[model samples]
Target: MSRRVVRQSKFRHVFGQAAKADQTYEDIRVSKVTWDSSFCAVNPKFLAIIVEAGGGGAFIVLPLIKTGRVDKNYPLVTGHTAPVLDIDWCPHNDNVIASASDDTTVMVWQIPDYTPVRNITEPVITLEGHSKRVGILSWHPTARNVLLSAGGDNVIIIWNVGTGEVLLSLDEMHPDVIHSVCWNSNGSLLATTCKDKTLRIIDPRKSQVVAERARPHEGARPLRAVFTADGKLLSTGFSRMILLRRLKELALASPPGDAESLGVVCCDCMPTAQGNNFEEPVALQEMDTSNGVLLPFYDPDSSIVYLCGKGDSSIRYFEITDEPPFVHYLNTFSSKEPQRGMGFMPKRGLDVSKCEIARFYKLHERKCEPIVMTVPRKSDLFQDDLYPDTPGPEPALEADEWIAGQDAEPVLISLKDGYVPPKHRELRVTKRNILDVRPPSSGPRRSQSASDAPLSQQHTLETLLEEMKALRERVQAQEERITALENMLCELVDGTD
Candidate 1:
């Protein structure tokens, strides 16, 4: 089931070098950063936005063209009433960026100008549905204007960005806060992870749950579940282990004639646990082994799956042995920090030799720095046309068609033909960045620089500054919300008073 095939950067250091095992350095300041796909509309140019965590509403839009001389102010995207929590670029539109925030709304902006072309602030759009804070927003992998957002209200709302309407609302499905939502490459399947220790797959069109895994992990706070390069599901949770399986496998495993049976496969994999110890009586000997939480990732070229253990900080690589039906562990990479979100470059024929490390950095603070690992672009697993193309996949073809039909000026692709090495210029990182935090149980003590404050401290400052600039708007929103709640409270008071 697995075959070997392959593949596949530079840097500037604003932070002084620390000279540790990994050439560790410190001092650069990055509030947030994300790894870009090699086919990223910007290509080779690592794209991400960084915010000043201390209270500034301004954000630095980075078009990291060259690692040696990264231009920080390429485009300063502004206009958020509060500190922005999440920022993502359109997979096919480099000039478009969407952000979710503590401002209780989501806004889509045209990059560079930071102009808000679309804003969801109406009572129904902002407050009527989600009673809690919105934590994340995810654009469909191949859909032009489709998006999915999960919030503190324990709901997932799929939105049609073009129409600015909620397509479907997934509520009462997850027992706890939903942390993340993602669409598979084909767009027919949507996966969600929740603090309820479950991962559910949904058919967004029908607004029904097709597949569900109960207690997918031992811990709550399921961080995220993502699709791999090969079109499998990887769920990561608080137990520090990622659950890996095939969507096809999951569907097939459902009851016959079940709605989930859409050519889905059935399978699963577990990370090997080391260090044998005393076994307690009455414990299932073979099954009671430590079920390390695995954050699954796929390497398309090698057709291998990497299981990152959040509990152990080690990556175990596996590959489907017989397609069964069988998956085999290949190799492993050990590191210090636990990885959060991970994905391979989406492109064909990428050179693997260029890949250096196992992960990338986002929102780093101390003088920004590129992740030591140079991830290779993920190649195509199956033929492009082989996938379920109901809603269509890949925007390139549609753009091409539009270009031919319309007399519009010649459209330029985000990436031109040529190989560009990954570079880092003006890279920023912070010692106390959230991504840099290692839980107390992770062992080593982390050192903090003067500006590297805890998230709580930064949150306090951000909240105060945000209240100052948008106090009127926020108070209005709160007053409306409180009025409704107060009416309910008054009714209760009258009933008891």
Candidate 2:
């Protein structure tokens, strides 16, 4: 018998550490619709993934420079008492991360610098209002300290993390649970998808639904949506499979403009897949038999929308233009290992000089691998073939510069020298001792005698007992685990008869 070889992707350099190492996340487990974003968006520098950690919630933040099991220096954000369903990296500050859990609370955490054991046991601030599990969180794209969270209570709460206050709460906005929320480029408007099978665009200033699109899909499947760079809404849901329940095509439901332009077109398989049985006819690497959800990440700087599917091993890219049909199919990158989750690095975080345009981190049963998407240039020289007349990223407003009652023009990255390659970070694994994260405290410092700070400086009995208790519990757990493994081995040996 012969095995078929997986074809190499011409446009992508998929890289990761070998799975033989103890790199797979030991605490995470496979989950469902989760509504939790697989990747947190502090792109280009850091990526965070939420996992089912024991009876509570925890997230692992990965540095873009390393792959395989995360290094000891990376911060593992934890503290919730239930599974973390969603996480969002603060757009205004890279060090800040916000997480939501089934525990009905949202926490804001600040990541510490490279230290072997930087565990976040307490959050800087906690927002508690929802009576149900908080499954969604989205950071304000243009403003600082602003966050949006939705829960099963069918409410949208805007939190000001700087003051630990709830700026606005549409306590009874939707009739059903909110599935997703998205901010427009300028941050003046927000769009939400709900279990009631509707998409509503809300003007936060007025706290009213300025426009809405009902029944986006013909069938009743869970829906996810995001705003395009030009302010149009793109949503994903399942198709009308009366029998098997197939996935739906990426749909651009509303017109590409302000709330006033939405009354024209209601969504479906969009222009590319229109009149073609409503199935997304992409060049997919794998045909998934199970129903999957398409999570989209859009890059305003490049005008590319990357669609990552749940329970599948492929990523499909499409281009959005100003012309009719708006969406253009690019290509699909596929692999043999199925991804339980995935994250994308932003353009500013990419190594543009090396002809690199995009990067994706894929999580498997045991490991997280990076897939680098490029435009395929021959040499490191400036080639227009790989460099389309691409526009730089346009910030609706600067981090510290947002004016009330004003919308600013978009900003751009330097088109001439924006993507010079050598400085871009290449993802690779660095081999070091597991204990290499910290240096011995041997720097210039005054030494103190044991009697100088007797009771205050020394470890107290209470502290020692607490540490011993923790160690004892850990040893007991390990012993039980070893016994279970031995019994399993014996069962396998006896079965050989």
Candidate 3:
């Protein structure tokens, strides 16, 4: 119940730390095994493997082909004594990646050589705060060198990556294991969903709870809560329940009595609205139940939440609206025919790209599985020239030249009116002939002029070169995206608990 304010110095430091996380990929490789779901990483030119369950971590690194195939032998990311639980690339440094493991430690590694840069042994700053196993770790979205870690002890800790310092520890709140911790867009608020069937909000800097509600999924299953793009409340929980719900402001239980405003009734003698006359109360209402869980991938581009059911392998997508209704069933890719631990590789249209899920990649019993989908790309769905009333490019434009030629001349014939204006007739004749005349010939056509021939050929060559340049750029972008998706798919395969 105690509320604390964050110091201004801490706020300035955290906010000023915002910068783009830089990732560079050079001399990196992907591991073999198309069907195996192993945790992976990529930044255009390189690929890194944190853990590969395939062949007992034997095929940890493979060379990624532009064709999306993995060729050649790759070594396991050495050093972790146990299976890595999660791996995250440093936002600004592609050379660095952070991983949490069952070994009760988090290690940050530099790619290529796969050397441990920071062991975080016993946690560089032991969140002695959490008495149980540390299960999850997430870096601040915009802040440089800031990380958030959650553990089995139902505690959350905020850390400074550069200094290896514990900035804040959040404990004594969640009743059960804290499944996840996410910061809002501005990093002012922290949203956590726990096994207690409640989603709680905290002001991270102050380490104090701003709001607490027991209205999340009721099954005691681990849940996830994330803020929407605008930092408004949007939470996913149980009972076919994904609630973008809000709490209502309550009316004060007791009416205040100002003695100055009271004419006759004495402050102590009036049948006062105090003590037993009133009771403190708090209530929450269930707005609506949204389906699916294991959290979801929030697509900021479309404002849609992609959710997969824990009970079944069904993937349901819902638009996060005023009440968040299920928009469509984004194709379901099932393993076990329909149940449990179904992982998803989140991207709107990645299933067809190189490294995309096709008939080629193989799937094993324990490895990660890939889900294929084809969604319209955001760029393709909208264009600057489009308006609601503007129809698509007019088909009639194709025959416009022919139509204009046929109607070019206006015939001026005699009008048998009682009164005919000579000037009017002349004006009509002049306008008609003006449009009917052929365009004046400037000179001999360029093809007939020999000296101009080289200029024409030069122009043609330049046009061809420009076209080729554009094509190369497009191909390169697609290749990079495919590499990124492959890495993401690998993580889905190997990092699952």
C-alpha RMSD of each candidate structure in angstroms: 21.2, 14.1, 26.8
lDDT of 1 by residue, 303-366 (tens): 4455544334354554433233234444455555443333233332122243332332322233
Q: Over the stretch 110-221, how does candidate 2's per-residue lDDT look in tens digits?
A: 7653432446676778889888999888877666577899998988888777666677898767999888899887687888989888878888767888778777655575
- Show the lowest summed lDDT stretch of 10 residues, model 2: 276-285
Q: Residue 42, candidate 2: how far off, in angstroms?
A: 4.9
Clashes of 1: 47
What global local distance difference test value does model 2 have?
A: 0.64
The C-alpha stretches of model 3 lying farther than 4 A from their native spots are: 1-73, 113-131, 240-293, 310-312, 322-372, 376-497
- lDDT (0 to 1) per candidate: 0.44, 0.64, 0.42
lDDT of 3 by residue, 1-497 (tens): 98896422111211101111121112223223221112343322233454344322221332222223233333355444445555554443434556655455555544443322222232222223345545577766545556677776677877665545566777777878776777765456777777776667787766677776664434433556666554444454433323653221111111122121211112122222223111221111222233324445564434445555444444444443221111222333344433223223222112222222111111223232334333323353332221112111111211122212211111122111211111110000011222235567688776657656656776787799789969977976796688689989999989894
TM-score of each: 0.52, 0.69, 0.48
Predictions ranked by TM-score, top down? 2, 1, 3
Give the number of the best model, judged by TM-score.
Answer: 2
- For TM-score, candidate 1 versus 2, the one ahead is 2
Model 3, residue 249: what's the lDDT? Answer: 16
